[model samples]
Every structure is written in structure tokens, then in C-alpha cells.
Target: ASAFYPAALGQTTLEQWHDLFASNAQAPFFLSQHLAPLLKANQGCIINIIDALAEQANPDFIPYSMAKTALRTLTTALAKALAPEVRVNGISPGAMLWPDGEHQLTEQQKQKILQQIPLQRVGTEWDIARTLYFLVEEAPYITGQDIAVDGGRSLNSVQLHAP
Candidate 1:
């Protein structure tokens, strides 16, 4: 499932937070559970689209990060539960799209984020798409995995002091 309900902590209401978890985490779990019979019958797989922030602490986006983190966990757990018949996996994308509307970043802000990526650039949708394709069509033995489609952003070193 490729859908997200994002919300910041302070700016978000409790209901929004609930919805974020519901859409990002709970929906996938329930949908997969309900569709398991069909998928197992057809020997199909499930791919959950998560975010790179799922593995890291993002205080600015606490709800979103938490929801995706739950999704990551669900991916692993579901894989183990529905194995040997229907595989379940996830893809965590990073910087695949610029924030729109009020969340848009300045040019300098965008450049700063790009500088953190080891590849020194943002990733393309094709990068994520190809990974999804690989997990769905090519990798038969792989399951219960969340592959990061980041441009090495997740590997950025922790710097106590800047050079």
C-alpha cells in the first residue's frame, strides 16, 4: 500500500494522530490480513511503501515518523506470519519528492538536505519504483525486509562538531 497520513506533533490534533496511525500502520495490517486468503491462493506478495524517517528520530514529524516506524515493524512481523506462500516486504524512500505548498523548503534548505546524502543528490521515483519491481517480481527468497531506497542519506554519520 502506498499511502501516508503525515502530521507534526504540536500542530496536529489527537484525532489527526490517530488517523495517521490508522492510515499508515493499521490500514496496511488490516488490508493485508483481509486479503491474505486471496494473495495466498494466487501466491502473491505485498509491498508496503514506507519512509526513511521511519528508522530515525524526527521530532519535527513525530506522528509521521512513528506511524512509518510501526509500518516497518508490521512489514517484518507480517512477513514471518505469511511466509512460504505470500511474501511481504517494504521499501523506504528518501528525498524522492520535494515538499509542496506550505511545507516547501527554500533553495538553501534543499541544498543542505542534499549535501547530507552520500550520493550528493536526491533520489528519483524510478529508483524507488525499480526497487519495488525487484522485490515484487525478481526476488523470490526475500521476505520480511524493508529496503531503503535512499541515496545513502540514512548512512550519514553523526557529527558532534562540524568540519
Candidate 2:
């Protein structure tokens, strides 16, 4: 894709990873490769959970971010292309969970994040699941957009410190 977000992907060359992520010319792309059939059958919607860090800021996971951003864009494009039949949308989650195989988090680190959230707490998996359920089963008219479940982290600017 571009330069600034250059990061080593596992063990593969950065260029190779970039090609795999940003500009794959293969058929079905990704979700369509598998879900095209299922979605058509069930007339279901696509809820792609694009990470908040995707197009945001991060020193680590830069390559992953680039890939997710492409996925997010695809969600919008797919929604429009499949409109009046299939629905597609994205959810951008911010600081939802620590990465797997977690190490201990410092109290300061935890407080720093909590303060940024207007809700003043971290999000849980249930929060996401319920939201999806609503947009899918409840909101029949919704599509082609993202509902940010960030607890207002995107608006954060003021510094927070643990007492």
C-alpha cells in the first residue's frame, strides 16, 4: 500500500504482506469468498468489526491496521453494491480488549484508558454482541455505516493519570 506504515508481518517480507492486504486481485476478495453464499441464502447482513486502531494511531500493529482499513472500506462498498438485498456495515471498537496472552497491566495504564472513555469504563464483549443484535434483528433500515462502540475514546484529548 504505502510506506509510512511499514512493519514486519510475522516472518514474511513487508512488501509481500502489503500485497496480501491492500491490493489482492483475487476472486471473492475475503468475506465474499466464503460468506457470499451464506449471506445470499439467509439474506443476512455483514457486520465487520474493524478495529479502532485500523485507520487510527499505533506504533505496533501498523500492518494489521492497513489491512483492517481496507476491510472497513470494503464493508461500505459491499453495502452499496449489495443494497436493497444484502446489508453490510462495520463496527469500530476502541480499546475493547487487551491482546491475547496478556501480561499484567499497570494500574496507571488502566486508569489512563478509563479516563478517556466518556462512559468511564472499559467495554465488554456483551456490549458488542448486544449492539450487533439490535442493528441486525432490530434495525431493519440500517446499513452501509459503522457504529463506533468506543466509549468516546475517539474524542479523547485530556490527559488522565491514576491517583
Candidate 3:
């Protein structure tokens, strides 16, 4: 389960941090651990859906960002640990969908984000799906890598900091 709790560092509580980690990082870790034997037996793969901002410092969404970054690290570790049997990789998607509820954006904010993407548009779910298909079915030798299906949004650092 991916979490997107947004809060500043000073405003975030320890419980929120733990909850974010539990949802974003810990759950995947333990699930993979429990499924490792089966995965190895069947030669299955693990593809983690991560955020494109996982490597960046998101001050407004501190705990969520930290948790995702931890998941990114976990992806690498799992890839190494599960190698030669099961492949593990991550997909870091950017601006694929609009944030709902309290995190919803205005039209201007949305436009600003679109401008940052080299494709000048948001990504579709199919974008991620095709990438996943490629990784699982075609990319046999690829592992421990993160593919950014962000329409080149990850190529620019200014998108996440839109005002």
C-alpha cells in the first residue's frame, strides 16, 4: 500500500511517521520476506510502485517522502537479496494522477506541474502498466533498477517545488 500523508517536518508526529513507514516500506518488506520462498520457487518478480519524488527531499510531505525513500532503498536491498531467483525492481511515477481531498490542486498548480514535464502532460496508468509489462516479461537481465515513468518529469528537479 502506498501512503501520501502530507505534513511538514515540524507538524508531523512520530505516529504519522511510523504509520507512513508501515504502509509504504514495512508492509512490502515483510510481505516479500513471507513470499520469498514461493517467489524463488516460481521465479516470480517484485515490482514496487514508488513515487518519482522518492529521492528528493519533500519538506511539505516529510513522513510520506521519508517512507517512500526508505522503500526505494528497500527495493535495492531486496533486489540484491533475492537475486538469481526472483527479480525485484521499482517504478517511480510522477504526476500520474491528481491528489484528492486535502491535497487537491488548483488548475494553476496543475498547469505548473504539467509545464515541468518534458512531455507537457500527466502520465496515464497505461504508461506504468507497459513499463511493468516490459520489466516482468522482457527485461530478464534487469534488476535493482528504478524506471521513472514520469514523461520525463524526473529529468527536471523543479516540478516538485511548484509554488
What's the count of clashing pairs in each model shown? 0, 0, 0
Compute the lDDT of residue 145 as modeled in candidate 1: 90
TM-score comparison, 1 vs 3, better candidate: 3
The residue ranges of model 3 lying beyond 4 angstroms of the native Cα positions read: 158-163
Highest lDDT against the true fold, candidate = 3
lDDT of 2 at 122: 78
lDDT over C-alpha atoms for residue 97 of model 2: 62
What CA RMSD would candidate 3 show?
4.4
- Model 2: worst 10 consecutive residues (lDDT sum): 20-29
lDDT of 1 by residue, 1-163 (tens): 4345445556888887887788899899899999999999998999999899887787777888888999999999989898889999999998877878887889999999989898988888899889999999999999999998888888774557778
Error of 3 at 64 (Å): 1.1
With a 3 Å backbone cut-off (N, CA, C), the pairs that clash in candidate 3 are none
TM-score of each: 0.89, 0.74, 0.91
State the lDDT of candidate 3 residue by residue for 1-163, as single tens digits: 5667777968988888888889999999999999999999999999998898787787888788877888889899999999999999999999887878887899999999998999988988899999999999999999999999999877776546558
Model 1 lDDT-worst window of ten: 1-10
Residue pairs clashing in model 1 are: none
> What number of backbone clashes does candidate 1 have, counting pairs of residues 3 or more apart or in separate chains?
0
